[model samples]
Target: METLRQYRENLQKIYGKNDYWMVPIFRSLFSMTFLFFLSRYLQMTGKLGNPMVILSLGLLSFFLPFSFVPCLSGIFLLYYFYTQSILLLGVGALFFVFIFIIQSSVRGKYAILIAAMPLCFFFRIPYFLPLLMGLTMGLSAVISLDLGILVYYFLRYIREYKDKFSTGGDLVEQLDAFSGNLAPFIKNKELFLVLLLFTLAALAIFVIRNFSFNYSFETALAIGLCLESTAFILYPAVGMKMNLTGELLSFLLSAVLSIVALFFWHDADYRGTEFVQFEDDAYYYHVKAVPKKKA
Candidate 1:
């Protein structure tokens, strides 16, 4: 424990001394990574195949606030829809507008949930998003996460069924078909299972973190992972096909990343050794108080 405390103190000192530039660098790196993958996904889908556009988006993401990344992504989706069909673009616009409103509202703070949703498809670790948000954010973040999930699935549906859509149909007919298809997608048992599992995991983590206990963060993470793993196992038994190996690997990576992030957050907020000096009659005394690091 003493060694661990010393290590944390050392980390705190280093971070405190160099965090200003380090933060932006890290943020830019994350943005670049996200954009690189996003562009790759687009290319793979044959949606936006232009390498230059992908490069431009990657550059744009590096400079844009993290909050804007999702919006830019939504725009890119819209552009893709436009290339496919005007009717598809119209549907995309409606979805984007709705999401935009929700994001711009007080819940906007949780918009990262939306941005992280698509990444889940590629890098399964993103499934930890709800758990992380639940641990750190208010209950409303769950709603943001749900909407984000819906958006991801919706976009995926469009991509997969684009060929089946009738471009010559009347507007109302097209919308009806779209709505009919979306209703089933939204009610998909697999989708609901994932949503329920993540929501419960997040809530559980939130509850555990609030308990007055040592190693609360670690405990919460363990509990969350257990819940996630259980769901993954049971879902397969119940007839939901999933890549178990990929999900397990993702969970492991996400857990490590979350732990590191938690450490950084805790250290950043730490107030180092407090001391007091007092003089008494016939004696002069100095006292020091050192705060213990929470496990």
Candidate 2:
């Protein structure tokens, strides 16, 4: 019993301080929720491809925010250049050129941004909202992928570089021997509590969706909020132990909850919202009875 306790303590020490516990949990929950629901939404209308394609979609989802940072900036600069009386096109183009330089330099480390760039306009959402939504969604996605990448490399590195870093066993031997070791537990009791909480959250989502069809927007927003908050609370503790499966499941559940929140609890129309351009080159839309006009 004491040996198990010490082993768990050593594992925790390797992960970090107690403060880090929430990192894995929250990250898994949020990333999963965003990817699952968003994919489901895309799937319903036949816009999505096969399951393998959809499963891989989260890989593209993570970098949308970083890409949006440049995309939106570029868009705004272009708008200002054209709409206002300014010879800013050359300046804006130059700025984007610089951005490309930075992007290329960091491309190996931040390749996800390149993938998310095109997805910004795919939803045909309001310009600002897409940027915001894409970012929130992308954040969870990126962090989740990063965690997986870090875990794989960390495990591999501990094997290859173990002697250089520590007086422990030969790196390769240790790594090859690790699979036989019992998986480390972050907080066994706490995990059960969290799982129960997630189950309850799932139930809440189901009840909401059953009665509501016009819920996509609210669902998206709610899941975004929940995942973000929970991630803030859990990712540190769970770390890489919170694998892709856990992340995927949490995200899917959150998406369902979000859908439920939107249709059953909130008032919004998911269909028949037309993007109408008015005489003064302004656009307005009304989904059901909700009025949305451009500034």
Candidate 3:
């Protein structure tokens, strides 16, 4: 236990010392990934799909603050949407405006959740958002997670039905079509089940992390993975008709990604604790806390 604690502390120290550089690298990587997937999803061929835009944005993201990356990505997405369809552009703009209002009202705390939406779509790892948010953020993050899911499904629906909207129609017709596309998402039992599973997983992680034990993060992750895996397995059996293998594969990948994210989160949040030692006149203090190992 001492060795594990020391190792974790060392890892945290290393990260803390280099976070200035490391953060930009991560931001750039995330930006590039988001752009790549966005282009592919939007079918932006020719110059639009060229690597130049991605590389340029990645370089720009590296130089810009982390907060700017999401905004930059949003601009890129809007440009793509405009090129595709004015209706899509309008809807996308309104959606993002709503997100902006929410974030502004909340002091930008849920920005990461908003950013996670694109990555979730690209990686088929929407479940990780709730898990991560639940562990690191407050219950309010549930709202962001839901909004992210809504954006994802909406974008997907647009892609699938882009052909139907190729020819411009009356505003009422377009609105009706958009509303129709939303029905399945609202009514689909599978989607709601997935959302419930994520909420429970996040709540489970949050609860475990507060258990006054060592390795709480790991335990939380393990429990969350089990919960998610169980849901994936049982979803098809309950008449969802999903592809079990694909679902499992996505879940496994998401779990791995979530673990990596948690490592960084743990290190960032707990880095100074190991070296924290202070004493008042009342008592001399020494502390070396160990995380609880799984039973």
Put down candidate 1 lDDT per residue, 1-295, tens digits, no spaces.
5577677778778889998766656655655555566656545355355556665675666565667767777777787777766788887898888887876765665776787776765676765686677568887787778777777677667756665456677768876777777765766777777777888888888888776455676688788878777776778788887777877788788777777666644432125555678887888876555454653
Report lDDT (Cα) of residue 60, candidate 3: 90
RMSD of each: 6.3, 23.0, 5.3
Tens-digit lDDT track of model 2 for 1-295: 3564455557557667653545544333333343444334323223232345434443443444333333433443344333322323443365456545555543333433332222221322111222232223332333322222222222233334323322245645544544433133223443343434333333333344344245544454554446344643465565524444655554555455444333333443435454544343575643334333211
Off by over 4 Å in 3: 1-14, 107-109, 137-140, 167-176, 213-219, 256-288, 291-295
Better structure of 1 and 3 per lDDT: 3
C-alpha lDDT score of every prediction, in listed order: 0.70, 0.38, 0.72
Best first by TM-score, ranked: 3, 1, 2
Please estimate how well model 1 matches the true structure, expressed as its whole-model Cα lDDT: 0.70
- Model 3, C-alpha of 226: deviation from truth (Å): 3.5
Best by lDDT: 3
lDDT of 2 at 61: 34
